[model samples]
Target: MSGNIAKHVFVMAGTGSIGLIAIFMVDLLNFFYISALKNPSYTAAVAFAGSLGFILSAISIGSSIGISATVSRLIGAKKRGKARRYAATFLAVMLCIATLLAALNFIFSRQLVSLIGGKGEALEGAVLFLRILAPAFPLLCLVMAISGLLRSLGEANAAMRVTLSGAVCAAVLDPIFIFGLDLGLTGAALGTIFSRILICANGWYQLSKHDILAFPRLKEIKPALKAIAPIALPAIATNLATPVGNLFVTRTMSHFGNDAISALSVIERSVPICFAFIFALTGSIGPIIAQNFGARIFERVKETYRWALRFTLGCVALIWLIFFLNQNLLIKLFHIQGIGIPIIHFFCDYLVEGYAFLGLLFVSNTAFNNLGFAFYSTFFNWGRATLGTIPFVLIGFYWGPEGILTGMTAGMALFGTLAYFKAKNVIHNLHLRFPEALA
Candidate 1:
């Protein structure tokens, strides 16, 4: 606990906290921009916002994973000086990449949203959201890198503070800016960006205090990148798949009209809360798995995986119980009234059914990703996103929004089965290969 264990938790807590809020940020955006949520334009805005956030997420995951991997490995190997050097170079590279990303995003905010089908007020709203949110990129990257470093170092408690700060900021500002100021969707985006900025500042301060922020240096970046790329790339690929799946979901829903799309947006924003326990489990288990795997404590690695799976699945099951008992009331919470009632019943039923299928898929993919089998995780997602699911959604063009949900459920149920089988194979193989590890 004094060494790698502490550092990993420290980073994990901060990263997970931000991750949790970031997961819910979509809802925050909608809550603030109530009109945008209902406007076909708003759906597009939501799509664009989701796409951009995800793209950054992919980049951040890739960059941070690599950085943390390289530094942590060196530290594990007792190469303290080398670890420091690696951390310094990684901070420089990631900051530059994040800054340039913000700039590029600023330039092409409108165009990017347009590709995802944004038009009219939604497009304008998206541009406003992106333009405002773009500048936070550098800070986000820096903080993610620093936070990852801290987690790698076992200053997890500090890292948690950084994320809690962002979540708290967004949580508080959501009501004040969105409802109070009536800033709507833009207000939500502002609150989220503001939160990220705050985390960035805090993360940077901690990172610098720990001497991880040695920017303005050009030394050894290539080697550092090389060291981190293998580990990070898979995680990035896994991260990118969410947006890819989102792109199709957006396209399919839009066919039913703006209102249908809007309803879909609401569910997307809200459903994650239902899966919170599983995600928290993944965050905690990943570093434990990573460190144990690093140290060649193979038995403990397998044992941890089993415990994580059982533990997560149990929590998910309990959540499902609560959801089942009060789904009607839960659906009512969105207050998706007014014109939103168009496909409201459809959404309520869809969530009730689809959540059951997604339960297995979501937890399995998370466990795989955390187990460092991220490429496998991404493959499952890519299958769901592009290959098997798109055809199912298209079959519903004539049926309207209800058909879209039905088709989506069908595709996911099919793909979720596929993911489940693959995960079983993985779990089976691990158990067999390391019998003593699990013992």
Candidate 2:
């Protein structure tokens, strides 16, 4: 509705986008590791490592959701002290959770790989990569918690700076460790972990200075978790939809052999790099929506959604065009070989077009989480995974990976439509109920 809102979205997006872009950029570097090794099994190993990392990071990511929910509300209520206490409790809880996850993953790395369909050297390599990366989970969780706390406090630029710095460090270190040291896959893991350590270290120092990071008290733990769990648990389940859905997709691709899964891995990692701004748009707008919703300014909430959808759609369109024009060049750039090339070609032809719908889904998920409709977000995602992915993928299996991409697109279309309408209705109802506040 106004230039000011658009300004806020762009400013926030500018900083927020870089963090994930850096993360995914390094993920692409992992794909490069696979290509450099020129082994299908190694490609599969990279795919498996990326998937497992996403699953592990869910603990922190989901906790960030809860932190955002709790902290945003507290910030809105002007409860800075309680928000600080919850922030402390969040770090403590996340540390315990991360440690437990790290231990389990380290001990069961092989079994975990096998569980996800890794075999032979691929299994071994993935295990090594995962174990090397496991200890960083705690550090990563702390980074996410602190960054999220800063975002909730309307300090998104600070959070952005914290995460982007990590990403930059990772980018510089990745090749050095992977290539320079001749450490291979384990080297990639080392680079990523070291960068994470940097983020966590810098994040703590920055937050402490802001008086945001605090020591956890025994008394605060219970209430902090109590406040956070309702939002966090559902949000976690909601977030799991992607990785779980991805797990199923990767498993399906595995049936087609390593080349297929490897190709899918490249696409997965690359797509985020191309569409980082979509994430930035959704993420940066969340606190804006949340604060307005809490303040009962329903129209501003609606306008935020409107501008976000416009921006995301525009960006995805341009991405589709760029990739379409340079499809052959991109294939050459990645130096993809074997069945992976055809799969990449097919994705660029068909699945790349579905990103607009996918972008809408990202926006709607943010809307639901910020507006207190997290369960809806969870429902749509899991529904897409099961109701959307399972049947289509089963049928598409007959036609190969192309068919699988078709199935995934169908799911995106279905849920994306549902999420948008649901978000609109929520805002409309809020408008009616809070007419006085709107005035």
- Give each model a TM-score: 0.81, 0.92
| Model 2 stretches with alpha carbons more than 4 Å out | 1-4, 75-78, 291-297, 429-439
Q: Model 1, range 348-415, lDDT digits (tens) per residue?
A: 54445564455556656765775557766777777877665678878865687677667777877787
Error of 1 at 342 (Å): 6.1
Please list the C-alpha lDDT of all candidates, in the order they appear.
0.66, 0.81
Clashes per candidate, residues 3 or more apart or on different chains: 17, 0
Instruction: Kindly give the stretch of ten consecutive residues in candidate 2 with the minimal lDDT sum.
Output: 430-439
Q: Which stretches in model 1 have alpha-carbon errors above 4 Å?
A: 1-47, 179-182, 287-307, 321-339, 342-344, 350-359, 362-375, 430-439
In model 1, how large is the Cα lDDT of residue 149? Answer: 85
- Roughly what TM-score does model 2 have, to 2 decimal places? 0.92
Model 2, range 1-439, lDDT digits (tens) per residue? Answer: 2458888998778667787786667678767755676777777888898888888667678888788768888878989889889878877887898899899989998987787788888888889888888888888788778787777777776777888788788778878887889888888888888888898888777777778656799889889989999878886787778888888788777777777878888888888888989888887898799878877877798889998998888887888888778878866766676777888888887778788887888899899887767778788888887888888887888898888888888888888888888888887898665567532
